[model samples]
Target: MSLGILVAVGGVEFEPSLLRVAEAADIYVVRRCVDVADLLATAASGQAQVAVVSAQLRGLDAEVVAQLADSAVAVVGVTADTLSADEALLRRLGISSVEASDDVSAMAEAIREAVREPVRSQPEFGENGPGEAATSAEEGTPPGRIIAVWGPTGAPGRSVVSLSLSAELARLGAPTLLIDADVYGGSIAPMLGILDESSGLLAAARAANLGALDAAGLAVHARQIAANLQVLTGLPRADRWTEVKAVLFRTLLAVARRAHAFTVIDCGFNLELDEEISYDTAAPRRNGATLEALGSADVVVVVGAADPVGLTRLIRGVNEVMAAVPGMVPHVLVNRARSGLGWSAQEVTQMVVRATGLATVRLLPDDPAACDRALVHGQTLSECAPDAKLTRSFSALAADIAGVPALHARRRSRLGRT
Candidate 1:
């Protein structure tokens, strides 16, 4: 019996010729799809074992290729250009078997061969290890670092930390990207005083799902908040979490790593893998976005409230995150540290270390007034209250994360005390 084949080469003159020779090669054209959607539908029927697609097919991306592969259909990408400039792009998009020639017989043979071989998995993009510098594709410079700010339940101030850290990093002369990956509620836009009419995270997710998102595409969705800082807002509603798939979320982070000098994510609090509730292994998980961000981050800044109740949740939460992601050593940041707690930073540090085995611990002073001012103005602490003690701490924390000298504090001293 002839092997089944699906062809979706739009407007290619040689497609008719290729189809004529299919019978001789022991393959039959099962369907001639007009577009990617039709192609996917036909492939899902399991009637086709191979799909011949044009490199210029609309909406053709790695995600689509993955779907075809999932349906047990081998994809053979064809480009009209003899020089095969499109071949590199197709390969980058995860199509391994490609035919650059217009010769009908050669195309048929390529299809036959693609069916014989196992479909190879897409090559992982952005191979730079966590915290390692990536070579930017557009510019030959090293890409940015990624820092994830996460915390336990009961409002430990993850969003505030993420906003301040990103602002501080950008203020220090590094181009920064702040991402709101919190699946539950993303307050980055509102915290930064931007309208949340359009969620940048959802737009980017849609683009990634269509395999159309690149660094430039990401820029289109991100809103410019500061001279050097840009933000990708999160889901507009909590229930929209299912729209952001974990695999595509990872791809988005990879693009982010190359686009900015520092990418800070405000992650959701929940650490549950949701495997127990996930009857469909492929279904989206509520915590998938948070898990992916933590896994991709070079630095995970775990925030905890300084009070006793907060500390208990913090210690337990820290252990949970560490268990969820092995080899993850997070930086413990105790927020709203008060002298009234009957413990010094050292004591709190010791307690956290003893419980979680994480050594790095820093404290942010309890400055409700400064926090209120910043929040009221919808600005970062550094912007509204540069001289506030909390602002200095934030600057110092950003410096530690970015491996640079303290920024705003030094600038203030050089200009003389106000």
Candidate 2:
């Protein structure tokens, strides 16, 4: 029987050790300088049956994970720490074994076992192949309106805006679906006080990979949050970004529209590229899930904080959004707006207009108490503090979006007619 081939990923620290282990195990070892991009390239080249990667390698992205998944290569992650959330994320991305103790010989044995085992394939969600284009019926089904709430790097209260806006829309009798598309870090489930083990994105990505993600399959995985609201949470693991691609996201939106009346996506900050690229040629680049979501959104809500740094990020983020998503008219929502450090709402709006040449549409007050309470309770603003200022503001925003006329004015008009 032929000895399995092993690829040492990450830096040169383990090269000599790996070679010795390979000799002892009677296996051929190839040392590849592992970076995210390089790792993906190596996997794509099909040169090695097993990959041993360092946990410390930066830019460990989803595309690399997906590449490994598609290649059926057994991956073993080496870390300095014993166990951590980061290690758990690596395992979620399909790395079969994690060696944190740096046991080079044991790592060799693990690699051999990984190569000997049958490559595990993700379960098919439906009949289509993964990453395939949507069919005509699926495309025409009107999945739902994708309302994406995005903002600059600083804390602009994306999760707050997302939850509040979704709740408000639901109150207006619009069946709403809230999706945590913030691939970097999303707090929807935590904020809602729901311990969601499954993220709709994972199921969608898996279906996309198998070309099986259709309208029917999306309904199966989506979790209903309320009578009029559903949510698709972000990936449980950051490395799972591999399964999600631009094509899959587009399909997800399409399917979402067909199932629900409205779909609200809490997209991540940073819209520069599909993924973050590395200064090093060897490191893998970050995937473009955020950018893709922004591009496909019907309405993009640009949020910013009341502080200087927040304002700066907001201005820069606006320009970036415009550049990447051409013809996307954004609605600016200034979060935590208050008279701070001699800056008023009017002054903030003026500065924003001057900097980005865009107009501000709405402002949300700083209601930290209400927000914290709601998040802790895993309840919406409507349930926790419907009378709160931020809640009312979000309700107004929803009314505007839904085109509902003012209550007193409508009543008066009816009286006049009578």
Candidate 3:
């Protein structure tokens, strides 16, 4: 089997000797990408199994690397400039194989090596020795469980569920931090009536990248909503996802988990690893936070609307997430499961189980008034509408997640208009 290489080196750097060396190694130069767009297009055409790209090429960021990987195209970065920063940037962007030598033979060898090390769906956690702890930090505390609340597009109750769940966990006396990780339009600030525009996520990201983030530094970024509930708002604009890198974001998550008893990430809708156009536009995908959050999560709560159309999207969304990371199957949460849409909770539950092959589903009733009150008051369900069935359900979820008996019995109440 001949390995095809898409060469994207500068025209000046593409010396005749480079071609001769690659061809000798049985690496056929099938295409020469002029830019990032052409590189992606060529890779998508299946003409290339490996990309021998110039590291100085424009639009070569982590997202670009990921899109190339999505096409199963291995990337071998060739740069004569062996600066440490450039190499670190490439690795962070998911490029593992890089040739720093100026020789054409080195480029050929790098392409061959990358072909042998293809990307795969990674496990949630990395390989560690038996009996070894996940973190050996000075803080000898078991980190809190990080639960990422995600859903499909079209405003499925992601924020509401995230807020209520975190609030309930805090109310149960577990130290909780509610993170608004929505890379698109984050409504956590307005919903909670916290008028501050300083996104804690960005602060944490900046600190994490600088290696200055710790428990106390993180505290400065959070808003103490209640005794045990803290809020970290998300991006001020939808286009600001570029501020967060996957590796740096992962570091922030570790600090948050260690600092709290429960850290809940209110994630965005998109899960796509979007193909990039250029290095200028090679910002992190809008759902970089969501994917990283999911990958880092101990549990994932996927909320979907319960109407017929909603259920269909939910099924597909769940399947897509499962396909992305087969190791972590999310807990399905069917929001608006009440009868207003002419579907019973039991029927929706059965449909979810059958269609998604998921073993369980949690139902949250359609209570517009209860949800409104919480939003209006900028308070959690437990605080705003304590007796509402929605509040009761959130509390129950919190209990199960915290692994403690609930302050109130788990209410398997009917989906009735209150």
| Candidate no. 3 TM-score | 0.66
Instruction: Report the C-alpha lDDT of model 2 over 1-418, residue by residue, as the tens digit.
Output: 3344545445646555655556654566654555766666766667777776655566554345445656766677665554775464554444557775457678667777877777643321222312222232333444356788888776688888987788777766666778888877768888876677888778877664444565567766776677677777777777666566754575567556656667888887866542235333332334356776777788888888878888888878888888888998788887898765578778877888888777555778888898888878788877778778777788788777667863521221110000
Candidates ranked by lDDT: 1, 3, 2
What is the TM-score of each predicted model, taking all chains together?
A: 0.79, 0.63, 0.66
lDDT (tens digit, per residue) of candidate 3 on 14-91: 445556655564878888778989998888888888887665677665556666777788887665565655554554
Whole-model lDDT per candidate: 0.79, 0.67, 0.75
Q: Using lDDT as the measure, name the better of candidate 1 and candidate 2.
A: 1
Instruction: Return the clash pairs for model 1, or none.
Output: none
lDDT for model 1, please.
0.79
Candidate 1 structure quality by residue, lDDT tens digits, 356-417: 87767889999999889878888878777888889889889878877777753347321111
Between 2 and 3, whose lDDT is larger?
3
